[model samples]
Target: MSPSAVVNKRAVVVEPETTGHKNVKTKSVLLHRHIHYEPSTVVAAKGNYVELNSGQKILDATGGAAVSCLGHGNQRVKEAINRQLDQVAYCASLFFGSSAGEALAKELVDGTNGQMARAYIVCSGSEAMEATMKLARQYFLECAPAQPERVNFIARKESYHGTTLGGLSMSGHVGRRALFEPMLLGNVSRVSACNAYRGMKEGESTKEYVARLAQELDDEFVRLGPQTVCAFVAEPVVGAALGCVPAVPGYFQAMKAVCDKYGALLVFDEVMSGMGRSGTLHAWEQEGVVPDIETIGKGLGGGYAAVAGLLIGHRVIHVLDKGTGAFSHGHTYQGHPVACAAALEVQRIVREEGLVENARRMGEVLEKQLKERLSSHPNVGDIRGRGLFWGIELVRDKATKEPFDPKDGIAMALHEKGLEPKHSISLYPGTGTVDGKSGDHIMLAPAYNTTEADITLIVDRTTAAIEDFFAQRSYH
Candidate 1:
């Protein structure tokens, strides 16, 4: 098939026509996320590009949901994994502790400036959230006063935590929760997210808006009977749910105050925003607050392994250490040696190479380039983010900030268009940015080590993809 045909087909897998491989056209048995659209088969990935079987080398702008912080194929991480494998690939966390896990945990705790006392490593963001919920509940149970009645959790509307039942219960993403609402925990409730673009009223000062939000949170606690609340969960920088929206200055601080007043734990879900993706090592650092319980993932292993972790602050640690002296949770692969090794090395490289500083410097360039090139587009409603993480919200009417109909699939269409040979770029697309079901946004989270020239190429391709996507459609 020609490149044009491949582009027209939209995520169809292209079969090789070599004499030996001609008859290899077999239906895929592995259940893919999108059943109808067979994604292009990736042959190899290195640096910032993924080469597909169709001979297309696509630039990875979002790093596969912002996971690849170091980009792909880092020799240091590879060697670390190999070294861990040589010693032990997996160890039952309950029975034994591995050196890799110990080093990684120490690294994470140290990174937090000793503010966090312990680290519980897990396999994915969802698992980390699950562990976080269990740990928070346990902390309350083991507290000196033993507040077992503190069972409720409060999260923001239009936010995402994870896919697990506990995490999903805390999440406010409408589309993801629609089918599983019956199965979700009833104790969790939601308040408004800190979205200045939509939530801030006309002529409202940032201070006033923050005060209003804090009062809203305080009211929710009152409505739920503040004593019943266990935690107030939130992402320091909103990820896919709101399209990389950062909290307004002083927003998190106010929320933390409310949490403190109510004696509820403040849980920061940094699964997407942590690990230097947001310029700062921790997103909460910028907000001038430290969470009681924090989850870190995505960039932790830099796509070298499936890894995420929970960082426990001194308060939670003190309670747990004084009471049960044990966490009431365990996963079969809680601290997989290889994953820990990869993550430890990735963190080392991040610190040694000063990739965090690089992300901060490059983020400015990315932000400037994006605003200059695409901010004036008729369909571009808003551009917001920090560090290597950025998001572009698309709308039907820029004047009114009207999003396109959900059926239009505008964000995913832009994503697919970007993967076509002409564009050869990968963008992370998301819907439900405005509410939980009515907006479209594409996120860009390049690797931490991305160069200025890389930013130029990413912006060029991103601008072209957005332009070409809207150019082919009519609004009327």
Candidate 2:
């Protein structure tokens, strides 16, 4: 029953099999080719690693797409879930409120300088984003005395929000949105992202670049007649699509100013960059700007539970509370008691154990190690990121900064090579960093509790994998 006793117990580490790959031949019951044709069958996981059925222990460098922030098998989160289940596992938010849900919402809202006074819990980041979009729309309707024509949303190109229809409409990732283009809503418009690596001009000053972007945003609003734009959605730190690209100084302020001038709500998609992944509890905090709405997931539950939420700022909440007295969205499993309890405990542990500070400390180490290891490599283009969230952009030529052809599948190859037995690392791979087609990059977001040894292991294994992959290509 004691927390110290639980900490003393060793976690069960699943080992890979020495036998030949049998799972590969076995037809999977689930739809397997959703992302890739052949995916690794993870037998088990603990701490900051996952064991594949192939008998390889992979250092989860990307935290399973940057989801597992607290790592695996945290006893406290597990205990919280058990306790919540005993009390109440599920309660409809419409009928009655659950303690676990109420506490989790309070913790999230209170942690963020009270910028967010209302929290809407959901099962995934995509769901949270959908709710955010709906909330933004509803807020506009409530505030506008007359039925306002502000139904349009402005989102940056190459940015990803979620997979659902509404979220997809707000997203501009070409590849992910291509198939769903016909079905996507028509209320969304695209703008350029603040990706300094790719978008910044070669000789442009940072201030000039930010100003130019601000002008572009203003121009877009003008083109759409400012009042037609309801919300401008963006990720404070561009994740997956651009590979951990943070906006340059004055970028967010400029964007926020534009939104404010046009009377459009500012929404931050912090699903991948929030909950201490970006050194700050909220990614927007680092930019010195606050958003009307913010969506957080992944690290919110620290991978101990499936939970995501949309944090509504006081301004937006006030409008809704005064008008409709309720949000126009609902999910069957919204604020599931067990998930809330697990996430609440995970967040508490993150705060109590000083993991956020640890993330900031280790982030410096990670940056140093990465720069030392790969900065001068011929194929390595640019290394950029902040806090513990980092990305290494790959190019065919460092001088020209030309990206490898998408046909080469360079990012996928690097990911596969990292997962090989000789290397055994789990990396997050991304493509289309350059013009949404030519560039490739890998993201590294190791667990916050990782030690220096873990950092060294990650760098070593990553270096070896890239070297081996290039070496084989040279031979070929």
For each candidate in turn, the TM-score is: 0.94, 0.93
lDDT of 2 by residue, 257-359 (tens): 9999988899999999899999888888889899999999988998777899988898888887789798888989999999999999989988899998898
Per-model C-alpha RMSD: 5.2, 7.1
Clashes of each: 0, 2
CA error at residue 174 for candidate 1, angstroms: 0.5
Clashing pairs in 2: 16-55, 17-55
Q: Which lDDT tens digits does candidate 1 get at residues 72-164?
A: 999999999999999999888889999999999999999999889999999899899889888888989998789999889999998889877
Of candidate 2, the 10-residue stretch with the lowest lDDT total is 1-10
